[model samples]
Target: MSETTNVMNSEVVKRLLCYVSYDTQSKDESSEVPSTQKQFDLAKVLKKELEEIGASDVRLSDHCYVYAKIPSNLDKKVPAIGFIAHMDTSPALSGKDIKPQIIQNYDGGVIKLGESGFSMGPNEFPALAELKGKSLITTDGTTLLGADDKAGVAEIMTMAAFFLAHPEVKHGDICIAFTPDEEVGNGVEYFDVPGFGADFAYTVDGGSVGEIEYENFNAANLRVEVQGYGIHPGSAKGKMKNAIRMAMEFEQMLTVFDNPEYTDGYEGFHHLGGIEGDSDHTTMHYIVRDHDAGKLNQKLAEIDKASEYLNFKYGEGSFKVVRTGSYQNMKEMILPHMHLVEYAKEAMRELGLNAKSVPIRGGTDGARLSFMGLPCPNLCTGGANYHGRFEYACIEQMELCVEILKKIVEKYAVKEI
Candidate 1:
């Protein structure tokens, strides 16, 4: 790459630093689409920037979605594509006043985060060792870096601006969206898929630098309730049916060893994320996950059976489990049109990166959109440790991300049979 034509331009990096400053963490407990108004604060700014960059139909919707259409120049027929990234950060940690640590030419050892004991240690995260020679952007140990999707946003914005300035590139209509509440699972809830028309889309929200996911967990949120009859322990012996005890027992019936801490890599797990209980009433919250739909359904059934077994032992209606739909694997939506994945992979390879396809242990807006008649697969933003305090991203890898999006546009803009 020549000096003038090289990727990883300084303007993109500066824009990334500017984006990470916004605190847009979404609340899962909140019922609203954006979950927080702070997301809009960022969305408004992005819409203005998009307009300045010459994007057409740049609109920020009431639901806190920013959409822009980049027009095509070539006379040849090409499939319209969408590039998506989320604006909200994970609610797991604070995304406020993010202090990013920029490491230039990392040397493959323990790089302590700020003045704290937390570090990019090879002993702890061996993946850091793989990034020995790369430039890394990490948090300052006090707060999360919000790189989970912000890097994705920066990458998409950079590519969009690049294409707008260089109309000679001759790309097709490129649909770009920056969504809110992605961390809270409401990214595509109010999204107008038909409004922002595209043949397919790719979400820049996956981990690592080369991930391309079309499969994800068939998720279901579970709520278990236990009811017990209260009685005076001193006056009545064996009359006290403790609901808390029943609730604890209910949790015990499930395989505790199958927890997140004990699971990884395509292995399914039944995790109890939260629990609240007392002698008279008890409630437990869990999320069942599996890449295989059959296995996921089996886990949900097992949870119901566990509750039913307790109910049978204590009495009818003593304890019950309620299941609610969360998100489905996008593979069902993408399998029919697998070429989009191929396009993304070809783009990555053209930019000299690996084409690694993996199952998403979690969900994304793409997962929902894919089910909603859009074959969307997830792309990488060079981020890691998502939704956690230890979140970080490789700046050099983010540079690659921008280049990959450009190539995807280039590939589709001109195709020969």
Candidate 2:
């Protein structure tokens, strides 16, 4: 199971460790856009790192969003491209004080996360077996590895630094943006596109190296509140409207086939991600997703009808429902601007890396940016099992990822001293 790519620079490991040492976990329940203050800590450091690498006008906004410009060294006018990565990690696990363990020579065996029983192994995650001779950075079972987007951040930083230091390599204007609230779907809420001034962009926030994506689920969030009538059990007869029972009935109205557990790969599903409350009142949170816009609306219609039907059955005002637009599929928006997609794939191929272009089962900042007229797609970071304790990344894969990213930019733009 030894499949290591030793072509990457060893210095990348050093930069990655420093980036992950900061705690940048997002809090979904928070009212703020960033959701966590620690996110800015990392954002500020990245801003400094970019400036230190010769990025001009490196600035951190009031909301902790970081932006910087790398002017083109070439005199010819060309397309300006942007590279983006989110600053916050998922709220799924603790990201504080991450202890990243470096396995210089992976043996394809089980990796102990911590304690006794729970460990990351090939038997559990066969993907680890693919990194036999490669270097691996993993968490110690207690905290999640921030490599999900941080690796993407560091990779972009590494590439940008390379371009700045080697001005002899021609390229166009390169823009870097680090957004917040990505974990909660509000990352690009306040993003200024005209200010960014880039023809096309890519979010370097995907799994596995060489991964490129131009599609994502058309998503919306559903909030259902079941309000049951209260009455003493002893005195209740036909008047007792239990919200819990009604909520169950409402759920039963939808097709179980339209669920996440029953779907995979381009197939969308309705996921009941949150639920709470008892007896007198309750709330249920659902996520409706579909690649097809028509079908996406159909799912929302189904939810509306389901709620209306329950209301009709249990009398008026039996329940309430709200659906918020989360993110959209960028494929349709990207059709007119197809060159960006080809440019990225070609960039990877030119770097001797096979680009795996696919659709995202979930949402990304790129999804939102596309609707905002940016038409952004997602690129890989060479990490895997994101947002969990067992998460790990191939150091060598990220190094190559940085190289491919630079080449992608070089294809469309030039920066020469």
What tens digits encode model 2's per-residue C-alpha lDDT throughout 281-313?
889999999999889999989999988888888
- The superposed Cα distance between candidate 2 and the true structure at residue 349, in angstroms, equals 1.6
Question: Scored by CA lDDT, what does every candidate get?
Answer: 0.84, 0.84
| Candidate 1 Cα errors over 4 Å, as ranges | 1-9, 230-236
The count of residue-pair clashes in candidate 1 stands at 0
Name the regions of candidate 2 deviating beyond 4 angstroms: 1-9, 414-417
Model 1: worst 10 consecutive residues (lDDT sum): 1-10
- Could you give candidate 1's per-residue lDDT for residues 69-89 as a string of tens digits? 998788877889999999999
lDDT of 2: 0.84
> Cα miss at 54, model 1 (Å)?
0.7
Weakest 10 consecutive residues of candidate 2 by summed lDDT: 1-10
lDDT for predicted candidate 1 compared with the true structure: 0.84
In TM-score terms, candidate 2 sits at: 0.94
